[model samples]
Target chain A: AQTVTQSQPEMSVQEAETVTLSCTYDTSESDYYLFWYKQPPSRQMILVIRQEAYKQQNATENRFSVNFQKAAKSFSLKISDSQLGDAAMYFCAYRSAVRYQGGSEKLVFGKGMKLTVNP
Target chain B: AAGVIQSPRHLIKEKRETATLKCYPIPRHDTVYWYQQGPGQDPQFLISFYEKMQSDKGSIPDRFSAQQFSDYHSELNMSSLELGDSALYFCASTQGWGRANEQFFGPGTRLTVL
Candidate 1:
């Protein structure tokens, strides 16, 4: 079983500044994928970014990027130019690279980190 | 592109009562997944369906059942509900066989068991 861990339960970031949320996972499989999801007060789960375990280069989406250190089993999310709307609960999730039954694979998620962006 | 749609944005039930939640996937999406998130908790995978067939199972309780229809819509049925069953239920969908769990989630349905 794969388990994702987000050590920081809460994070505070000033507007226009940068914040890094830490996440680690324990997985025996060599092939897998890592992801970060944002849940706002609306309770919608939004995809922040994703990183493939095989890719050495980190993934970046607009102001969101990730520092994926595969060997250390760590995948951290970096939010640059943080805005007030960035306040939410961030989760780190893990998925197997292998596709199962041609669809709908499940994700194992961390407890989540609450990020607070203040002006 | 339209995202997954979960109907009955909120539902309130009592202990031992039954409830049903529905999900409509994005157009042409063949894979659908269900997740449950308790208050102040991360989402947990429940089950998934592909092509109207059960594809994968997770930590879903035995009292819960789900299935996809030919129209690509899915329904989750919960029986003998308990207070602990109160949570936000989210439905997600993905595209083809090669999809690497790039699922787009729905707005979610909040279920409250009284």
Candidate 2:
């Protein structure tokens, strides 16, 4: 079984500053995927960024990026030049690699961290 | 391209009644997923479908059921609505079954059971 944990329940950052959301996971499988999702007040879950275990390079999407530490089982999301639009509930998720049996690839998500971008 | 679309943006149902939510995936998407989101909680995976076949189901109850149509649209049905079932339901679509692929989500349907 796989599990994702977000230790920070809430985070705040001033506009134009940077913020980092912590995430950790427990998985025995070597090959897997990590993801960060953002949910705004509208309650829509949006994909922020993704990281593949096989690739050491962290994923970056404009101001959003991930610091993936495979050995430490840590995958943290960093939002640079934070804007008010960045305020939302962020979630960390994990999915196992594809198996020969064609098993289900369901995402196991963390509790979520509420990010507040102060002006 | 248009993202995932879910019908009945808001629904109000009475206890013991049945409710059905609809979702239309983006064209050419092979996988569709359903999730439930309560207030102040992360979205939880309910089920997923690929090529009209149920690929996975999470820790959902028997009253919760889903079906995928040939057009790639999916429907989530609740046999007996309960207060606890009141939450936001999201439908998502992905290009493939690979874990590394990103899933696009719909705006979601807010279900209120009284």
Candidate 3:
């Protein structure tokens, strides 16, 4: 079973600064995918960025990027030039590349981290 | 292009009553998923449907059931609603059931059981 963990329950960053949300996972599979999702006050889930285990290069989406350390089983999301719109609950998720008999891809998510960007 | 659309943005039902939520996946998408979001918690996977068949079921009770039609529309039915079942239900769609692809989500339907 794959499990994702977000050690930081809450994080805060000033506007125009940077903030990194920590995430770790436990999985025996060598190939998989890691993702960061954001849920704002409206309670809508939005994808932030994704990192493929096979790619050593981290994934970057504008100001959002990921630092994926395969050896340490760590995948952290870094939000540069944070803005007030970045305030939301962020979740780290893991999905195994190996599919089961059902052919369904299930996402294992962490407890989540609440990010607050102060003006 | 339409993303994912969920009906009944908000619903209130009495205990033991049945509630059904609807979802319409984006055109051409082949997979549909249902998730539950509780207060102060991350969304938890409830079930996934592909090719009009149930592919997987999450750690939910037996009272929860889902069905997908030929048009790729899906419905979630809660047989006996409980207070614990009160939460936001989100629907998502993907082009395929691949771990590498990203899933698009809907705004979600909030259900309240009193």
Evaluate fnat for each of the predicted models and list the values in order: 0.80, 0.85, 0.68
Instruction: Give model 1's docking category.
Output: medium
Tell me how far the alpha carbon of residue A84 in candidate 1 is from the true structure, in angstroms, after superposition: 0.4
Q: Candidate 2 overall Cα lDDT vs. reference?
A: 0.90
Using alpha carbons, what is the TM-score of model 1? Answer: 0.96
Candidate 2 structure quality by residue, lDDT tens digits, A1-119: 88899999999999999999999999888888899999888888888999989899999999999999999999999999999999999999988877633456888899999999999
Once fitted onto the true fold, the runs of candidate 2 whose alpha carbons sit more than 4 angstroms away are A99-102
lDDT by residue for model 1 (A1-119), tens: 78899999999999999999999999888878899999999989999999988899999999999999999999999999999999999999998876532323588999999999989
- The candidates, ranked best first by DockQ, are 2, 1, 3
Give the candidate number with the greatest lDDT: 1
Model 1 chain A: weakest 10-residue lDDT segment is A96-105
TM-score for all models, in order of appearance = 0.96, 0.96, 0.96
Backbone clashes in model 1, listed as residue pairs: none
Fraction of native contacts, model 3? 0.68
Interface RMS deviation of candidate 1: 2.3
Tens-digit lDDT track for model 2 on B23-68?
9999898899999988777788999998999999997789999999
lDDT of each: 0.92, 0.90, 0.90
